[model samples]
Target: MEEKKRSGAARYCTVPSCKNNSVRNEGYSFFSFPKQTDRALIRFTRVNYYLLKWERRNMTLPKVFVDIVAKHPHKVAFYFEDDIWSFQRVDEYSNRVANFFLSEGYQRGDCVALLLESRPEYICLWLGLSKIGVKAALINTNLTGDSLVHSIEVAGSKAVVFGSDFKNALKDIQPKIVNLKKYQFNENIWLSPPLFDDAKDLRTCLKEAAMDAVTEHIAKGNLKDHILYIYTSGTTGLPKAAVITNVRYMVMAVGLNKMVAVQNNDCIYDSLPLYHTAGGIVGTGQALLCGGTVAIRKKFSATNFWKDCVKYRCTIAQYIGETCRYLLAADDKNLVKHNVRAMFGNGLKAQIWKPFAEKFGIKEIFEFYGATESNSNLVNIDSTVGAVGFVPFYARFLYPVSLVQCDEVTGEPLRDVNGRYITCGENEPGVLIGKISTLRAVNQFTGYADKVATEKKILRDVFNEGDMYFNTGDILMYDDFGYFYFKDRTGDTFRWKGENVSTSEIEAVISDIAHLSDAVVYGVEVPGAEGKAGMAAIVDQTRSLDLEQFAEGLRKHLPVYAQPIFIRLMDSVELTGTFKLIKRDLVVEGFNIDIVKDDIFFYDVKTKRFVPLTRELYELIMKGEISCPDNFD
Candidate 1:
């Protein structure tokens, strides 16, 4: 295959008065092209070869940021609301943060809890911690009380640095985390409480610290050391802190930057929370790696989303499935006014993929698939609609991912008569697992801070004895073209009538209904029922559900067992900071009309209509008196 031509012009040389252009090759630069014609080609080839070798050997998060600072100190590194920080400014700020921590008796390998919103300070602090060999445990700002305490405690954090925005949340968990030292950002030291007596303004500290602190720390840093602890969303239970090493951060930054073809002049608009991997490592880190500017938003507002993009002159934007859905629901006519050429992130459902692209005028939807802790990554670089990623058969050995048959009820990999896990056939949905190897450290699973939680994510003795793999806990399938499609979460798939029911599949179909804003599908338990029954929480914008039209659409598209039996008309569905639906509460409430205040509807098979589920009908269904056509013993 012929190599693709490089995009755009060469970057200006960083060296003063060099009068040479940095040559771009394979998404990275290799110094400036020499003017000597006699040895130009030979010199170019030699330089490129050595740079590639050096990149593979010495690439690390701190090293990359330092290199960018050296190359383009005046370049804008980040834009947060009304503030803009240049590469040199951020580097100096991070140096001060490292110096302050060192003065506080904090040493390498110490874990410091960071509970801050999506701001320039958050990134600076994280980078500073990495420079000094300290790990920053990124806690979700929305978390409170037990959940907050669990995340910090699990990471074994010695200190907690929090912003003023989280004062209430910090107060609520103060008693629980009394043992840990507290420090408040942007606060007057004298006004802070005794517990937070060490509070000092970041800017003040940066101004006072020596300039060489960052340089000395970076030189002593090792790539193998842990730099971050990102907590999971905890959709099932309490969250777990996934360890992120410098090696992992470097891989994520470089891989995403190269895949997206990020350039120095490009500006990336990011609205997702920094605590999430998509916002931090993949979105912001990609820009930092490529010497591009990152536009950070405090929170996602569909009304102001396009305006912000236009204001920031963003060439690329990051999104999740719900972010696109919310934007599509808004009445913003400025959607087509931005310069965004590509939309990058995961969870872009097949139903919304084309409409979102066309409506927003996006040229490419760079959908990718990977969990925070998982080593396996897949990116759809070919612009294939609805495909999370593609891995050719020839590249399967390098990727090392497998779709294995799973037991529907337990959500465990199914074994054959010989006790070996069965690999799924082509086009069949199964749990995706990645082979773990210590030889290739990038492919190894670093797991969570909690040993029990870490062990739960590993599946052993699969295919061969003494072999291990990391369970992704996600169901996926691939087609003849090797394109992978997301099905549902392992826990979200329920067994009914001897068939597996995917909640995501049902939700996708339900989303096609007119005037429906959102839908969250899940399985609910019914007394005397053989398996869980399908239920959905739907947000209808019209305030009137056309049951006849909805029933007809369901009958035409979905199988009998796949259709939701109970429909709870909710005002809105709760979502996490990253835009993932919170289904645990809805699943617990079920279809009980007495407990749930929302209007409930039951599909009446005999009348072929959805009727109000009153107290009388709910009791009858609970008693197993009402017989539904889809329900089978």
Candidate 2:
């Protein structure tokens, strides 16, 4: 830290005629990483070897704006559609932006909301905020109106910088804000430009930002306080903001980079929507930290995706289960032409995992599990073939994770009088409640002014009196190998014939049939079926699914009763602010064929034309006597 202070005050003298004249300070800025020989860095990077030596100690995250410039200044730091930013230029831009934020009264611990997409601007803002020790509250640009407002308010932002495209959403809450800065750029948001016209054009906006900054000196804060909030896709109630504190789990950057050992020359094609953690935290962050460049995009586009990967020479990439599946559905004469060696991200299903890897010719597939708030993450480096893998922390809790049970009839969690909820044995499905302890380091939620809403998520007196745990609302079923399997989200599980059906597990199969871009599975009400009837809303890939073909496939694959009673062909599935499918809205509408205008599909055991779901068929389907699988067979 003393060395850090002196860094800003260093000076040099110019000699004239063999006489040293005056000294001028060439002060190093926050954006500067101290230069070192290759020898020194090789020695320093050995810190990776003895990291446990520094456990429980404070170490700043190596801001890529600093370290990256020091090592690979001229290498591309970011690339998008047709634009590219060099590490040197990115370092300079982030420095000016940091200085700008500082001049604007932004300081350490101050929350600055970034409403943008996965552009270079997002990276610049992230680096700039970290350099100045300000906390970045990254907002999802997809959110609109109230959902957007609720997120910003929950973050307790000291300032906000809105993108040009989302200016309308910003305008909705400008009056509610105390201090804000409206920044407009070209149409694509979050800094990664589709193309860089010239350095001067890029510099113009940054220079304006620098001039308007409002602080005397930038504050230095602990790494734990740097990032403030990350929003979860609210499929259940409203979307809630999750904090990303440093004190708890160290950012996974170091471990993940080590797992991949990505080369500094690697160009990581990352188009996973900057609002997602994979894009922002894991994608860009991992690449930048390794001195590799990030090839970014606003969102994933199946058509131009691989072309861009080859165009940018992407060596690494990331994906969700569905995105990879989408790619699998594409025409792939050129899929093998790209430089994609390894891919990382979650949600890749077991059934398709092997096929996707083999088809893509991918060398490594890294499957990981984590949430924005949890202290645990399971990283699968061994390509463990088809498991979520294991983290020590997660492995430690698997037994406890399965044992807890909630009421079947009512969703209200049942707790003992002592407040300690019982956990399931190994491999049993149960809700995962994070154990609260003095050592429990986690990013607490950003409450929406309603304490009751906040209180609903907490469980008290677990394991001991006064101990509290946050309800993750996710159910996990563990395998015997310390690998936990993802179960359905709360309310996604339906009971039929006294058996629980995981909507996700079922949809994973339904979605694999080269069918739709999306499949949202939910339980619909049935008159006598004990719990709920399994219904699926599918968005057909061709906009027209052959009912006979789909029914034939479903009947061949699924159990007699497991086949969906009704299949609604929807043009679009409504997603929440966080891009998660909203089943509640789908549930409210139910299976009323007349009430919903979307194309309804029904399988008739006698004459299965995959009939247009009518009121009479829908009524019969809900009566528990309909054997949907018997139609095609």
lDDT of 1 by residue, 1-633 (tens): 014323211211211211243333333223432222112233323433433443467656787788888998998889888788999988888887888888878888899999877888889888888888899999877566555787888899998888866777778667787778877775333454333434545545566876565677777776567899987632344567898887677566656666656677788999888988889888788655668898999877788788888888998899876577667766766454888888788877666676677788787677888888987777765456667876655456756899999976446789999888999877899999999987665477888888888898888899899899999888899865466888766665664432346676667678775456588888887754444678888996556878789988777556576678888887876665523236766877888776899888898988988889988898898886885554211
In model 2, where do residues sit more than 4 Å from their true spots?
1-57, 62-65, 171-180, 187-205, 208-219, 234-236, 247-249, 259-266, 391-403, 408-419, 436-458, 465-468, 491-633
TM-score of 1: 0.71
- The candidate scoring highest on TM-score is 1
lDDT of 2 by residue, 1-633 (tens): 455334322311111110232211332233432221122234324424423332344444433235556776788888876877887777677777787767667767677777766778777776677666776777866555445666777777766666556665655555665355444445533465432111123335566765322233223445445464676533233345665654332345554565546666677888776755667777876555556778888767777777888888888888876567667766776464777888888777666676677677677777876666543444555454445544322225421232367654333456776666776666677766655444323223333234565576677776677866766666665543344566645654554432335566557667766346588877776543334567788886456666677777666545444567678888776664633236666876877866788887765666744677766766776674463442110
Q: Candidate 1: where is the Cα deviation over 4 Å?
A: 1-58, 187-207, 233-236, 334-336, 492-633
Model 2 whole-model lDDT (C-alpha atoms): 0.59
